[model samples]
Target chain A: MIQFYDLAGARDDQRLSPYCWRTRLALEHKGLSYDAIAWRFTEKDLIAFTGQGACPVIVDNGKAVHDSWAIMEYLEATYPAHPFFDSPQAKAHALFIKHWTEQVLHVGLTKQVVLDVHDMLADRDKPHFRSTREQRLGMTLEAFSADRDAVLPAFRAALSPLRTTLQKIPFVSGERPSYADYIVFGGFQWARVSSERDVLEPSDPIYAWRESMLGLFGGLPAKTPARGAILAK
Target chain B: MIQFYDLAGARDDQRLSPYCWRTRLALEHKGLSYDAIAWRFTEKDLIAFTGQGACPVIVDNGKAVHDSWAIMEYLEATYPAHPFFDSPQAKAHALFIKHWTEQVLHVGLTKQVVLDVHDMLADRDKPHFRSTREQRLGMTLEAFSADRDAVLPAFRAALSPLRTTLQKIPFVSGERPSYADYIVFGGFQWARVSSERDVLEPSDPIYAWRESMLGLFGGLPAKTPARGAILAK
Candidate 1:
C-alpha cells in the first residue's frame, strides 16, 4: 500500500488541502489504495524525509514523491493501465487547468475561507498558518475575509472559463473524469472541505459538474465532511 | 479547395478575427489548403450560405461550416488521417483553452486593441463596428483606449495562468502545436494584426512561446503584417 502524507485540519477527518485532494482523487482514479497519514502545517518535521515542507507527499515502498502535479505524473507513469495515462496533449492541456487552479481558482477560493482554514487547523498549527497567510495576503485573516461576500462575485466570474467549458462537455477531461477533472475539482473540494459557505449555486453548470464529480469513485469526495454542499446544498 | 470567409479590415490581405485565425490554423494543422476570401463585419450577407453572420464560415465542396470551435471540430472529424485525430481527452481539454481564450484572453486583449480594431476597419465598416463595440462596452472607443497603457499591467497579470502553464509545457497542447495553441495564438494574432502597441514584453515566457508559434507552419503567422513583435518589434 502507498503511505500518503495528507494535509489535515483540526479534525483528523477534515482533509482540506486542495493539493492533497488532487493527489487523493488521482490515487482513487488510478485504483491505488494507500494509508493516509495526517499531517498539519506546523508539522514540517514529519515530512522532512521528503526534503519539502508540504502535504500530499507519498512514500511508496520507501520512495518519496512530493507535490500534487509530480505525484500525479508519477502515478500516471507508473500505472499506465488506468485512465490517468492519456497522452502528452492531454497532459499539456490539463496543465492549463492545474495552473488555473494554482494561480486563479485557488487564490479566489482562499479568500472565502482563509479564516475557516484557520478555524479548522490544529491548535498548534494555527499561529504559523495565520502569520504566513497574513504576510502573503498583506492583511490579517479577519480583515482579509471581512468582505468575503464582495469576493464572491469575482470568484464566480473567475469560473467563467470552466463554466463555459462545461456547457459544451460534461467533464474537463472530456466525457469521462480524468486528472484534468481532479485538478479543477480540487478547488471546489478545497472550498467544500474547508468552509461553511456555499461556493457554488445549484443553477451553475460547474455546480452540476461538481455534483457528478462527487458521485464518481463511489462518492469518495462526497463522503468527506465538508461545510459546503457535497451535492449542491 | 476549401473556401474560407475570413475577417478582414482595411486591407483585404489583413485577417484580424481571432476565431477566423483558429479555423485557419486548424486547417493548416490538418494539411488542408483553402482559398481565404476577405470579409468585413458589414459583409454579413457573404456568410449567408452558412446561415450565420460570422466571417469564419468555411465552405468545403459546397458544405458550409461556421464558428471557429465548430470548424476545428469539423476539421478533426473530417480529416482523420493527420495528427489531428489524437484523442477525445485532448479535444476535451482543448475546449478549456478555447473557452479560456474566448472568455478571458479575448476580452482582455480586446481592451488593448478596441480602438485599433476600429482604426483598421474598412471605411464602410467603421461606423457600425465602432457603434456596436461602444454599445457592448458602454464607452466610446477613444474613451476605452485612452488609458490602454494602464490596462496593460492587469492584462499581463491576467495571463499568469497561461504564463505558468507555458513555463512547464512548450505548448498549451503539450509537446507540439495543436488546436489549443491556435485558440490562444488567435488572441495575440488578433492583437498583433490590429494594433501597433506591444502587448507582451520580450522577457515573458509567453513572448518566447509566441515566437515559437510565429515560426509554426513555415512562418505563416510571422509572415503576416502584424504590428507587434512577430519578429521581436
Candidate 2:
C-alpha cells in the first residue's frame, strides 16, 4: 500500500492542494490505494524525512516519491501494465498540459482563491500561511482578490484555448480520460474544493467536461468535501 | 503534388499567413510536393472554387481542402504513411495545441505585428486589408499597435504556457517535431515574415525551440524572405 502524504487545509477533509489532487487521481488511475495522511502547511516537519517541505509525497513500500510530475511518471513507469502514456509524443504533449495548468491556470486561479484557501487553513497555520502568501502576492489576501470580479472577463478570455479544445472533444485526451485529463483537472478540483465561486459557466463545454471529470473513478473528486461549502453551512 | 494557395504580401515572395504556414509545414512533413501559389489579401476571387476566402486552401489532385486543420486531417487520412497522430488521444491533444495557438498566441501576436503585416501588403490590396483589419481591431492599425512596446512585458507574460512547455522539452511534441509544433510555429513564422522585431528574447527557452523549429525541413522557415526587411533594406 502506498502511504500518501496529502496536503490538507484547516479541516482535515479540506484537501485543497492541486498537486495532491493530481497524485490522488494518478493513484486511482493505477488502481493503487494508500492512506491519505492529512497534512497541513506548517506540518513540514512530518514530511522532513523526504527532504522536502511540499508534498503529495507517496511512500510506496518505503520508497518515497515527491513532486506531482515525478509521482505521475513513477506510477506510469512502475505500473507499465496500466499504461497512461501511450507514446513518447503523447507523454510530451501531456507535459505541456501539466506546465500550462500549473504555470498559467494556477497563476490566475491563485489570485482568485488564495484568500479563500487561507481562511480555510487550521487556525494555528493562518499566520504562517498569511505572511508567506501575502508577501508573495505583495498585498493582503482581500486586496489581492478584490478585483477578481473586474478581472473575471480577462480570466475567462484567457481560457480561450481550453474552451476551444473542450468545444471539439469531451476531454483533453479525446474519447476517454487519460493522465492528461487528470493533470488539468487537478487545478480545477483544487479550485472547486477551495472556493465556492464558479470558475466555469454552467453552459460551457468545459463545464460539461468537468461534470464528466467529477464523475470519473466513481466520483472521487466530487466526493471530496468542498471548503467553506454553503450547501449546509 | 499539392497546390497550396499560400497567403502573400506586397512581394510574391513574402508569404506571411500563419494558417498557410501550418499547411505548408504539414505538406513537407508528409513528404509531399507542392507549388505554393502566392495569393494576396484582395485576391479572394482566386480561391472562390473552395467556397472560402482563406489561403492554406490546398487543391490536392483537384480536390480543394480549405482550412489548415481540415487540410491536416485530409493529409493524414489520405497519406497514412506519415502518421503524426498515433492515436485519437494524440490528435485531441494536438487539437488543444491548435486552439491554444489560434485563440491565445495569435490574438497577442497579431497585436504585435498587424501593422507590420499591413505594411507588407501589396499596394493594390492595402486599402481593402486596412479597412477590414482596422474594423476588426476597432481602431486604426497604427493606433492599435502604438503601445506595443509598452505592452511587450504583458504580451511576453501571456506566453506562460508555451514558455513553460519549451523549458521542459526541445519541441511541443517531445523529441520530434510534429503537426503540433507546426501549429504553434505558424503564428511565429507569420510574425517573422512580416516584422523586423523579434518576439522572443534570445535567452528564452522558446527562442531556442524556435531555433530548432527553424532548423527543421532543411531550414525551410528560416530561409523565407522577411517582409519589408530593414536589416538589408
Candidate 3:
C-alpha cells in the first residue's frame, strides 16, 4: 500500500489542498489503495525525506515522489495499466492543461477561497499559511478576499475555455475520467472543501460535470467532510 | 486537390485570416494539396452554398465544410493520414485549446492589430469589416488600436500557458506539430501577415517555435508575402 501525505485542515479529514487532491484522485483513478496520512502545512520536517515541504509526497514501495504532476507521471510509469495518458502527444498536451490549471484556474480560484481556506486550517498551520500566501499574493488575506466579489465575474469569464470544453465533452479528458480531469477537478474540490460560497451556478454545465466527478470512484471524494458544501454531499 | 476558400487582403497573397490559416495548415499537415481561392469579407454570395459566410470553408471533392474546427474535422475524417489528433481524448482536449485560442489569444491580438488588419484589406472589405467589427467592438478601429501599447502586457501575460508549454516541448502538440500547434500558430501567423509590430520578444520560446512552424512543409507558409515582418520572411 502507498503512503499518501495528504494536507489536512481543522479536521483530520478536511483535506483541502488542491494539489494534494489531484494526487489523491490520480491514485484512485489508478485503482491503487493507499493509506492517507493527515499532514499539516507547517509540518515540513515530517516530509523532509522527500526534500520538499509539500503534502502531496507519496511513498510507494519505499520510493518517494513529490509534486502532483511528478507523482502522476510516476504512477503512470509504474502502473502502466489504466493509463492516465493515451499517447505521448496526449501526455504532452496534458502538460499545457496542467500549466493552465496551475497558472490560470488555480490563481483565479485562490482569490475566491483563500480566506475560507485560512479559516479551515489548524491553529498551527494558520500562521504559516497566512505568511506564505500573503507574501506571494502581495496583499493581506482579508484584502485579497475583499475584492473577490467584484472580481468574480472576471474569474468566471476566464473559465470560458473550460466551460466551452465541458459543453462539448463530458469529462476534461474526454469520455473517461483521466489525469486531465483530476488536474482541473482538484481546484474545484479545494474550493468545495474550504468554502460555502458557490463558485459555480447550478445551471452551468461545469456545475453538472463537477457533480459527475464527485460521483466517481464509488463516491470516494464525496465521502470526505467538506467545510461548507453548496451541493449535496 | 481540395478548393480552400482563404481570406485575402489587398494583395491576393496576403492571407491573414487566423481561422482560415488553421484549415490551410491542417491541409498541409495531412499532405493534401489545396487550391486556395482569394476571399473578401463582403463576398457572402461566393460561399452561399455552405449556408455560412466563413472564409475557412473548404470544398473537398464537391463537399462543402464551413468553420475552421469543422473543416479540420472533415479533413481528418477524409484524409486519415498523419493524424491531427492521437485519439478521441486528444481531439476532445484540442477543443479546449481551440476555445482558449479563439476567446483569449485571438481577442487579445485583435485589439493590437485591428487597424493594421483594416489597412491590409481590399477596398470592398473595409466597409463591411469596419462596420461589423466596430459594432461588435463598440468602438472604431482607431479607438481599439489606441490602447495596444498599454494592453500589450496583458496580451503577453495571457500567453503564460503557451509560453510555458513551448518552453518544455518543441511543439504545442508534443514532439510533432499537430492541430493544436496549428490552432495557436494561426493566431501568430495572422498577426505576422497583417502587422509589423512584434508581439513576441526574440528571447521568447514562442518566437522560436513560430520560426520552426514557418520552416515546415518546405517553407510553404513562409513563401506567402507578409506586411512588415520583424523576423526573416
Candidate 4:
C-alpha cells in the first residue's frame, strides 16, 4: 500500500499547496489504495523522521519518496498500464511545463502572496509563511519584503512567457491533466485558497482551467486542520 | 532524424553546460543516432525559435523538447526497451535523485564556479555567468558573494542527507545509472573536472563515484566533440 504524508485534512484546502495535491491526484488517477498521514509545519521532527524536511513524502512498500515531481514519476513508472503520459514528446512537454510551473510560476505567485496578501492571511499561518520566505531568501520578513518589492516588476515580466505558453494549451500539456497540470494547479490553488479570489480572476483561461481542476477534485474541501490542531502535539 | 541543439566542439571550453551533458549521456545510454548542432549562448535565438531560451533542447522528428529532465523522460518513454528506469520505484527514485542533482547540487557547484573560478573560465563564459547571477539573484558580484557566503553553510548542510544516502547505495538506485546518475554526474563531474584534483577528496565517496562515472565514459576526449558525440544537428 502507498502511504502519503501531508498536512492532515489540508488536502481539501486549495490554498495550502498544490504540489501535494498533484501527488494525491495522481494516486487517485491510478486508483491506487493509499493511507494519508498529515504533517504539521511547526513540527520539524515529522519531516526529519521521513529523512527530508518537507511534507508530501510518500512511503510505498517501505521505500520513501520525497518531492512531488519524483513521487509522480514513481507512480507513472509503477503503474504503466494506465499510462499517465502517452508519447515521448508529451512526456518532455509535460516535464517542461512542470519545471516552469514549479520554478517560475510558483515564484511569481509566492511573491504576490507574500507581498500582496500578508495582511489578510490568518495570524496562525503567518509564521509558517514568514519562515518559508526566510529560508528561500535568507532574510527576515522586513528584508524579504523589501527584496520582494524590488523584484515585483521583473517577476511580472518573467511571467509573460509562461502566460503565453499556458494560453496556447488548455492544460499545460494541452488536453489531459498530465503531471504538469497537477504541479501548476497545486501551487496556483494554494495561492488562491490562502488569499483572495481576485488574485486569479484576471488571468482568464488559467483561472478557468484552475476552476476545472478544482471541480475535478470534487471541489477543494474546506475541512483543513484547525490552526490549533496543526500546532498541537 | 533526431537533431539535438548543443554547443558541440571546444571552440570555447566554457561553452559546455552539465545539463547538456546529461542529455548527451542519455543518447549514448540508449545508443540513439542524432545530429548535434553547435550553438552559441548569445545566438540562442535558435532556442528562442522553439519558444524557450535554454540549450540541450532536442528536436526529435521535428518536435522540440526542452529541459534536460524532461528530455530524459522523452527518451525513456520513446525508447522503453533500453530502459533508463525499469520500475516505478526505480523511476521515482531516479527522479528524486535527478531533482536533487539538478536543483541543489548544480546550484552549489555553479556558485563555486562562478564566484571562485572567474579568472580561469573562458572569456565568453564570464559574462554569461555574471548575467545569470544578475538575472537570478538581482545582485552584483560583491552582493552575490556575500549572499553566497551566508548561504554556503546551509548548502553544505543540505548536501549531507544526500551524501549519507549515496554512501548507502552504490548508485542512487543501486548498481545501475538511472536518470538520477546521468543528471548528477553531469554537474558533479563539472565541479570535479574544473576544480583542483583533490578538491573533492577520497574522503568523499561522491568523489570516487564521480571518478567511476568518468572511467565509465572513458576519460574526457582530447579533441573537439567527436568521440563522445551521440547526436548531430
Candidate 5:
C-alpha cells in the first residue's frame, strides 16, 4: 500500500493542493490502492521524512517519494500496469503540457483563488501561507488579486490554446484520460475546491472534460468536500 | 519524390511561413526526398486542386494534402519509415504542443515579424497579405506591432514554459527531436527567416535548442535564405 500525504485546508477532507490532487488522481489511474493522509501547510515536520515539505509525498513499501512529477514517475516505474505514459517521447510531450499547466493555467488560477486559499487554510497554516505567498507574489494576497475581476477576461482568453485543443479531442491525452488530463484537471480541481467563483463557463469544452474527470474512479474526485456545490453532478 | 509547395517571399529561396517550415522540417525528419517549389501567397490557383490556398501543400503520388498538421498526418500515414509519433497518445500529446505553438508562439512571433514579412513578400502578395492580416488584427500591421519594443518583455516572458522544459531535457520530445520540436521551431524559424531582430538571448536554453535544430538534417534548416544573416553558422 502507498501512503499518500495530501494537503488539507480547514477540514481534513478539503484536499485543495493542486499538486497533491495530480498525485492522487495518478495513483487512482494506475489502479494503485493508497492511504491518503491529511497534511497541512504548517506541518512541514510531517513530511520531512521525504526530505521536502511539499505535499503529494508518497511512501511505498517504506521508500519515500516527493514532488508530484517525481511521484508519478516513481509510480509508473514501480507499478508499470496501466501505464501513465505510452513511451519516452509521449512522456516528453506530456512534460510540455505539464509546463503549460504550471506556467499558464496555475498562474492565472492563483490570482483568482489565492484569497480563497488563505481564507480556507487552517489557523496554524494561515501565517505561514500568507508570509510565503506574499513574499513570492511581492504583495498581499488581497492586493495581488485585487484586479481579478477586471483580469478575468484575459485569464479566460489565455485558455484559447486549451479550448482549441479540447474541441478536437475528448481528453487532453486523447480518446482516453491519461496523466495529461490529470495534470490539467488538478489546476481546475484546486480552484473548484477552494473557491465558489466559477472560472470556466459551462459552454467551455473544458467544463465538460472536468465533469468527466470528476466522475472518474467511482466519483473519487467528486467525493471530496469543497467550498460550495461546484462539483455537483 | 514529394512535391512540396513551400511558401516564398520576394526571393524564391525565402521560405518564411511557419506552417511551411513545420512541414519542411517534418519531411527532413522523416528522411523523405522532396522537390521544394516556391509558392507565393497569391498562387492559390496553383494549389486549387487541394481545395485550399495553403502554402504547405504536398503532392505525393497524385494525392494532394494541405495544412501543416494535416500534411504531417498524411506523411506519417503514407510513409511510416521514421515514425513521427511513438503512439496514439504521443500523437495526441503532440497535438497540444501544436496548439501551443499556433496559439501562443506564433501569435507573439507574428506581432514581432509581421512588418518584416510584409516587406519580404512579393509585390503580388502584399495586398492580400496585409488586408487579411489587418482585418484579423483590427489594425494596420505596422500600427498593431508599433509597441514591439514595449511588449518584447511580455513576449519573452510567455516563453518561460518552453524555456523551463528545455532546461530539463535535451529536446522537446526528450532525448531525440520529434514533431513537437519542429512544431515550436517553425515559429522561431518564421521570425528568424523574416526579421533581423534576435528574439532569443544567447543565454536562454531555447537558444541552444534552436542552434541544435538548425544543425539538424545536414543543416537543412540552416540552408534557407533570410533577410539578414540570422542563420549564420
Candidate 6:
C-alpha cells in the first residue's frame, strides 16, 4: 500500500505549495491507491522518525521515500507500466526540467506567493497563517517581506532561462508528461489553486500549460484535508 | 567523443564542491576518452553557449548536459556499462543520496569554502578569484560572505544524516559506487583538496572511505591530473 503524508485542513483555493501538489498529481496519474496522513509543520516528530523533516513523503510497502524528486523516481522505477520517463533522451530532458523546476522556478514562485499567505487564506485562518509563517521562517512578517522582495530580481532572472527553455518544448520535456511536467505542475497548480487569478496572467505559454494540467487532474479528490494548510506551514 | 567543459583555474576543493569531481571521476571510471575545455568562471558567454552559467557542464555525443546530477544521469543512461545505478532499489537509493548530496551537503560545503575563497586564494590569484566568484554568485565578496554565513547551519545539519547513512553502507548506496558516491565525492573531495585540515574533518569512516576512493582511482592517468591547478579555472 502507498501512504501519503500531507497537511490537514488544507483548502483547494488556499493550497499553495507546488512540491506537495506534484506528488498528489503523480499518484492520481499513476492511478495508485494510497492512505493520506495530514501532518502539522511544528509537530515534526513523525517526519524525524523517518530521518527527514519535510512533508510530501511517500511510504510504499514499508519503504519510506522522502524528497519529491526521489519519490517520483521510486514510483517510476517500481511501476514501469505507467512510465514517468519513456526514452533515455526523454529521461535526461525530464531530469533537467526537474532540477530546473526545483532549483530555479520554485525559488521564484515561493518568493512571490509565500509573503501573502495570510491574505490568501480564509479570513478565519489569518492568525494561523501568520503564526505558521513565523514558526517556519523564524522571522517577523516585516523581515520576511523584505527578504522576499530582495530575492525577487534574482528569481525573475533565474526564471528567464526556464521561460526560454519551455518555449522550445511543448511540455518541460515536450509532448507527453514526464517527471518535469509533474515538478512544474506542482508549483503552478499551487499558485492556480491558491493565489488570485491575475498572479499568473502576465506569463503566456506557462499560464496556458498550467490551465491544461489543472483540467487533467482536477477530477482527483484532495489527497488530504489540510493540503492547503500543510503547504502554508 | 565525450567533451567536458570545466573552469580552468578555479579552486573547487572537495569541501567547496564535489559535483565537478563526480563528473571527472565518472569519466575515468567509464574509461572514456574526451577533450576537456577549461573555462574561466567570469566567461559567461562560454557557459551561456552551453545554456547554463555553471561549471562541470558536459557535452557527450553532441548532447549537452548541465547540473552535476543531470550530467551523471546522462552518463549512466548513455553509457550503461560500469553503471551508476544498477537496480530499481539501487536507483532509488542513489536518487535519495543524490538529493541529500546536492540539496544538503553541497549547500553547506559551498558556504564554508566559497565564502572564504578570497582568503584561500590570496597568494595564488586575487583578481581571478574575485572575478570568478562574482560571475558564479553575481555578488561582491562582502555580500557573498554574508550569504554563505547565513546558509551554514543548513550545511552543518546535512552532515549528521550522511554520517549515520555512511555508518551503515560503505558507499552512499552500499558496496558498489553509484551516482550517490560521485555526488557526495564532489562535496567531500572539495573540502579535502581545498585545505588538508578544515570544516569537513577527515575523521572516522568518512575520511577512511574517501581515502579508499582516492586510492582505488589514483592509478589511472585520467583520474590523477598532474596538478589541481590544471583543472581549476
User: What would the TM-scores of all predictions be?
Assistant: 0.96, 0.97, 0.97, 0.48, 0.97, 0.50
- Using lDDT, rank the candidates from best to worst: 5, 3, 1, 2, 4, 6
Tens digits of lDDT, candidate 3, A112-224: 99999998889999999999999998999998889999999899889989999999889988888788889999999999899888799888889999999988899978888
Across B71-164, the per-residue lDDT of candidate 6 in tens digits comes to: 7778777887887654443443344345545655665666666644455442445586778768887877677667655665555543654555
Comparing 2 and 4 by TM-score, which wins? Answer: 2
DockQ of each: 0.74, 0.74, 0.78, 0.04, 0.86, 0.05
lDDT tens digits by residue: candidate 2, A17-91: 889988998888888878999998889999898898998999988888899989988888888777777788888
**Candidate 5 deviant stretches above 4 angstroms:** A230-233, B230-233
Each model's total of backbone clashes: 1, 2, 0, 12, 0, 27
Collision pairs in model 2:
A10-A121, A10-A122
Worst 10 residues of 6 chain A by lDDT: A219-228
User: Residue B228 in model 2: shift from native, Å?
Assistant: 6.1
lDDT of 3 at A86: 89
Better of 2 and 4 by lDDT: 2
Candidate 2 similarity to native, TM-score: 0.97
Chain A superposition TM-score per model: 0.95, 0.96, 0.96, 0.75, 0.97, 0.73
Clashing pairs in 1: A10-A120
Q: Compared with the true structure, what per-residue lDDT tens digits does model 6 show for residues A1-92?
A: 69888643234334455677778777877889887665545446787757977778888988999877777878888877677655443443
As a whole number from 0 to 100, the lDDT of residue A82 in candidate 3 is 91
lDDT of 3 at B217: 85
* Model 1 per-residue lDDT tens digits across residues B89-188: 8888888887788888999988899888888889999998988989998998888878889889999999998999889888888778888888899999
Candidate 6 Cα lDDT to native:
0.60
Tens-place lDDT digits, model 4, residues A1-233: 88887653233332365677788878877888887665556556766756767778888988888888688788888887666666443454344345556666676677666543444344565578677777877876566556555666666554444454456555654556656567767776566555443344455566677667766645532343223333343
Name the top lDDT candidate: 5
The candidate that achieves the highest DockQ relative to the unseen native structure: 5
